[model samples]
Target: MRVVIIGAGLVGTSIAANLAADNDVIVVEDDPDRADQLQFDLDILSILGDGTSLATLQEAEVDDADMFIACTGDDRTNLVACGTAKTLGDPFTIARVKSAEYLRTWQRKHGAFGADHLVCSDLLTAENIVRVTGLPAAIDLDPFADGLVHMAEFEITADSPVASQTVAEADRFKSLTFAGLFRDGSVLIPGGETRIEAGDRAVVIGSPASVRGFSNDLNPSTTPDKADDIVIAGGSEIGYHTARLLEERESKSRLIERDETRARELAEELSGTVVMHQDATDVDFLSREHVDEADIVIATMPSDERNLLVAVLAKRLGVDRVIAVVNNDEYVTLFEEIGIDVAVNPRGVTAEEITRFSFESVAENLSVLENDQAEVLELELDSDSSMVGYTIRELDSELSGQFVVGALTRGGTLITPRGDTTLEAGDHVIIFVETSFADEIIARA
Candidate 1:
């Protein structure tokens, strides 16, 4: 597929890099320096021109492109670029929009602007925060279709009930199916005898009802805890976006801004949130405002130094959880080292979202990687395949190396197969294999 990406910043470059491996990609960037940087970093075509202009779209050959993505940080530019792409070509178009108001307005009016998809980074981040906060025990949660179905990651803690149970035995816990397990830096597609050991990170897929039931079975005492008091230190776009997200989740937040005019403007915009006109670095001011009582502290200020300082201070001040937005890649480890519960890089998060959305089939076709080398893939049984209607042990004859059929998805139901269990046509089977043997396994299966 031929893909044209506008804005060679982090998000655009990430999308280009990811798609370049399998598809033809061209990036259009306004900033000459950034465009040059991206061209130097990745093997993709770069066009230095304003993406919002019709001439730029024409110059980028949008008419022949299979996909056009507008990912500039500026909302107006992204929207105009997407509109121009739609006018210039019939290709699938996606726009990255940040404003909540714009999101609502765009959805209401001009709904058929020819943009195939609209990705709201603010909404994605907010949803992620809500999921993580709602289920503190879940290592990760990837929701599909606005929570219709979900893939959740949960670590097998010492307190987990199914720690030593086999795949078949643990299947009775709930109706959910175990997609894959990450253990010992390797992914394991467990069989009937495959045991669930402690320290294993298990990925499960199911509906909300089944997932909730499974979580309850895994940890009976687990409860949803809501953050009542939130302290946000920043008045930038990201900070404002975060505050709006928190308020939508029904959390009371206090936003600290050094600039009086900006603080007042934010205060007016976010009437429910408390806008504190003071420097976030002032520990005394934070203490005076009762930062001790905050359940969650979010530092999204522009400066990484100030964000790190405030995050560390919040951790010391007894905040339940601290999340800092670090723009620089170098500061990611520093934030973790300083005990910040979560460090979010908007660029990374946005890039991941775009990649995932773009490669919808890759998620199901590719295996879940525990490490960089090993992968666990779910393959569907073809009707004409030699392995169909054969038992697990019988099918082992054609396959090399140790392979296990972890779980089978047949007719939308998840089942843990035994050695005597037969693989039928149309059944999706999860298999674990080393990266070296991934191709062989897929081909043979």
Candidate 2:
């Protein structure tokens, strides 16, 4: 595949790096320094010019590109760049925007901005935040097969019940599959006898109930049913959306905003959320509200520094879980290191959302894990697929890539994968495998 990306910012650079390993990737950036740096770093063609310019699109050979992505920080620039790219070629155009208003408009009118798909960072981040709220101890979670299957990554703390358990012992859930483990800085494909140690991040895929059950097993005390007190700091778009989503789930939440006007606006818009007009970073205000007793605290302030401050405060106040929205990719590790349970990066979410579209028709849905070390893919099997007639164990032995069939859905019914289970045409198979073999496995499926 040939991909042409506009704006070499964090999202663009991530997309380019992800695709450069398996596809022909060309990046366009207005900053000469960034362009040169990316060209040298990724060994991909980087053109220094304005992405919204027709001349710049031509220089990047947009006419020959299979996919065109506009993911700059500025929303208008990204939209305009996608529109401009459409004039040159009919490449599958994707635009990343922060505003939900633009996404609504595009949804009302297909191809409104010449973009085949639109990824809203704020909304995506909010959805991510809400998804984890339902499963305690999950650092990341995504649904597949129309929510029939769930892939979740949980950090195994020293006190976690499953920290010292073997894969076979932890595989108590009937529908759950232990996909992989992240130890230190590397990815490990686990077996039945694999020992799960402290600090290892375990990845699992299964039904929603099974995943929720697994979460309870990991930390029996902090189950979702007992996680009632949810507090969100800051009334930014991400915060508002997160509260709104939690409300949709019939979960009443509290939102704290420093600005009186924004708090009023949010209060009026969200019926189920209690909006508090107070500084989230103020220790006195937090103590007054008994935030220490809260089950979860999410920091979604506009700036990374503010979010960090609020997250640190929440941790110090004895909050059970702290989730912070880090806009800068570089601050993700920093936030996590400071005891923040989860650091949600908007650009990282947007990049993952857009990169999945690059898979075209091969994968119905995709989730990148551990910074692209592995991926979970949902694929609809074709009649002529090489894997159609083989059982799970047979495919495992025949396939070149190391992968685990997590779950399958046939005719809207969920099926837990087993060694003797044979695959058939039209079944939606969700598999977790190393990133390098994703394309090959998809091709065979």
Predictions in order: lDDT: 0.73, 0.91
Per-residue C-alpha lDDT of model 2 across residues 127-187, encoded as one tens digit per residue: 9999898886799999999999999999999998888899999889998999999999888
User: Can you write out model 1's per-residue Cα lDDT over 1-445, one digit (the tens) per residue?
Assistant: 8899999887888678667766889999988998888888887789999998889889889999988888988888887888888887788888887776677776886544456777877666655655655554454565543344455667687768989988787766443567677887776666668899987877776666666666666766543445677788998777887788777778788999999999999999997889989998898987888897787788878899999999988877787577788877667767865667667776666776776667654334332333224444566677976678789888777677656554567777666566798989887776546656655665565
Off by over 4 Å in 2: none
Q: Flag regions of model 1 displaced more than 4 Å.
A: 30-43, 48-56, 111-116, 145-149, 153-224, 235-278, 360-445
Candidate maximizing TM-score: 2
lDDT, residue 278, model 2: 95
TM for candidate 2 is: 0.96
Clashes of each: 0, 0
> How well does each candidate superpose onto the true structure, as a TM-score?
0.70, 0.96
Clashes of 2: 0
Q: List the residue pairs that clash in candidate 2.
A: none
Model 1 poorest 10 in a row by lDDT: 363-372
